[model samples]
Target chain A: MPERSLARYPQAVTDWRDFSDDGLTPTLRAARGLFARNGYHATSIRAVAEAAGLSVPGLYHHHRSKQAILGALVDATMDRMLAHTRAAEADSDGTALGRFDNVLECLLRFHMLRRDDAFVASTEMRSMDDTLLLRHIAQRDEQQRMIADIIAQGVADGTFRCGHVDDGARAAASLCVAVAGWYDPTGVLTADEVVARQLDIARRIAGFPPPP
Target chain B: MPERSLARYPQAVTDWRDFSDDGLTPTLRAARGLFARNGYHATSIRAVAEAAGLSVPGLYHHHRSKQAILGALVDATMDRMLAHTRAAEADSDGTALGRFDNVLECLLRFHMLRRDDAFVASTEMRSMDDTLLLRHIAQRDEQQRMIADIIAQGVADGTFRCGHVDDGARAAASLCVAVAGWYDPTGVLTADEVVARQLDIARRIAGFPPPP
Candidate 1:
């Protein structure tokens, strides 16, 4: 990992402004907010600099371009999401369905907490140059494939039944990701409630019967 | 309905240019493609006119502003989708689950056919003025309610076993709408196949048992 990525871990940094001490620069955070709100194509480097309280030249000192900021955000988000999936599996009770539920719950909670970055990552794919888009998409597909593999394994072991494993997996993944687009943290449902509700939907999609 | 919209019905127009004859105009078609491809904010009136094979003055004669074009596109797409839902219900055999299946299959096929328009309608909601956005969202919510009501009826009838009717409805609707965002018509799956598979997933999401 790059030295700049150190601040992204949050636990590593006591102060958010200490880019030298920890790498979560204001410029990175501003870029993410602008891209998430106004969209990547509409946001300019000047806007990001102003939001970050830096001169254009000062901003360039830390990051090369707007694309670089977007690339970093996308990479970090995918990395974190994939890590959550693996962690969920490792902590699971060793059944495919249990692993599936754990992974779905992890994804639901992750998307809720990182909703803004998740929105930018999903909606701004077209704004990225081809190579960066492909790189990020590969990370996303790897996450999807992990879910797909679990569904396939469940089918093989008679733990799950569905019309098609791949379709079931995609539907399951899509349902979870869609939560980030519409979920409101301040809304009536608590985060735990949202996760629990979505896990139920995911289980149904995977052809697992509801618990009695 | 306007006379120009008649050509949009397909059976009424033998020649493609009948839209011109009826004053439906080529400008509308050009705007949809440009907005869907380049995005709403990035696409300008000059670009839309050029793509329509018209001078700027000519394009303005058809559409006074870009917002009008986008408004028309969003309104028409929502109207068509709602129509499909109602028609599916009207033609259904009257069981709640059968009505549910018909509506899901109809939505899947309509989304696949109008994928580009659907894309623009969804992603460009932010670019619309607040009043227009609310108007379109009302239509979208109405469509969601249709599915929600169906699930509610099914659950009350003991035909479905969902945890929560509203969340299940939202998840089912989101999964179907998302099909437009990623579907490739020229890819391995045909439209019928996509509809059939999505129907199966919808069934599971509704907490119905798979077909024997």
Candidate 2:
């Protein structure tokens, strides 16, 4: 797949620091908050419009339906996630382990720092239509494959000793994704600490050798 | 905390085989399906009554409100999960590693086989009121403590070498919980295979020694 920039995706924001009201349009900001809190099935277009401080017609002028808003939010989240993963890979030292560590760290940071988006993207996919679901699933699959491929390379190059590369990849990815569900911003551990701990866990999950 | 039996929790059921409509009351069965599919806020008491072939008042006779049904579902899920974890520990070989493997396996199976209940319990917690939320949070914390305590035991006994016991416990639990989000019943890997793979991954995460 061709690498797409954040500019190509209107809803895509930079990072947790970039997750301000300034980054989102009024419609998207309101919809994201409502959808994240109340869920898509329970949230109505009028409520989103009201929250965004616009009339229903005004909201419709930019986004036709609640589904559109959801799709936009999900799409934007995937776009930002994929961008981070790719950038991590691109900035790596060209070693499989290097790429693996960088990508995994990027994923952990994204899920923890941008947890609301991550939670909505992970949980509300069931509310998406078939086409929208397929689009996001493809993006998700691509991300999964990225991790799996890196693991495969590591195994081939003797950097990783995992017996089941695909399973190891899945377990590693699942561990990072799971952070979004439980990570507390106000908790004792800072985001960096959580990421560091997860990186250690991921390395072990991938069968990386201990330090000599 | 005192251990509770399935009999004490009316909504609790056995493993995947016991997930038939026969195990659930008509009201709960209907509500579970609707809540899993459409989410708690989107589902209505009338719809649940209609699906269960009961009148509005009759549904009320069984379930007082939509929130009540959601509470019952989440409570049942937690009850069943705790039961499985305790049972696995009881059935272990009286070793920390043995208990860890068994508990992780039980959790993986529960999440994959009873995915709808798992999904509902996970995603609908946001819709729960504070009291219900605290109750379930306590149950969830108990489960987390189970894994962490086992890991701590393993570390103390030199069976595990993880540097961060608490984070290791969290990662191990999170990896198993994530199976509910993506495990496809019709997929190639059976539930047992997934469980075995996760156990291997968990052992690695706990830093158990390789064969000498």
Best by lDDT: 2
TM-score, every prediction: 0.86, 0.90
Worst 10-residue stretch by lDDT in candidate 2 chain B?
B1-10
| Model 2: how far residue A150 lies from native, Å | 1.3
True contacts kept of 1: 0.43
Worst lDDT run of 10 residues, candidate 2 chain A, spans: A1-10
- Tens digits of per-residue lDDT for model 2, A69-112: 88877877787778778878887897989999988998888777
Off by over 4 Å in 2: A1-22, A210-212, B1-23, B210-212
What local lDDT score does residue A103 receive in model 1, on the 0 to 100 scale?
85
Q: Kindly list the per-residue Cα lDDT of model 2 for residues B1-212, writing each as its tens digit.
A: 01112213544334422333323556776787888888888888899999989899987776667887777767777877787788778878979899998888888887877878888888888899998999989999899899999999998998888888888888888887888888988999886787788888889888887322
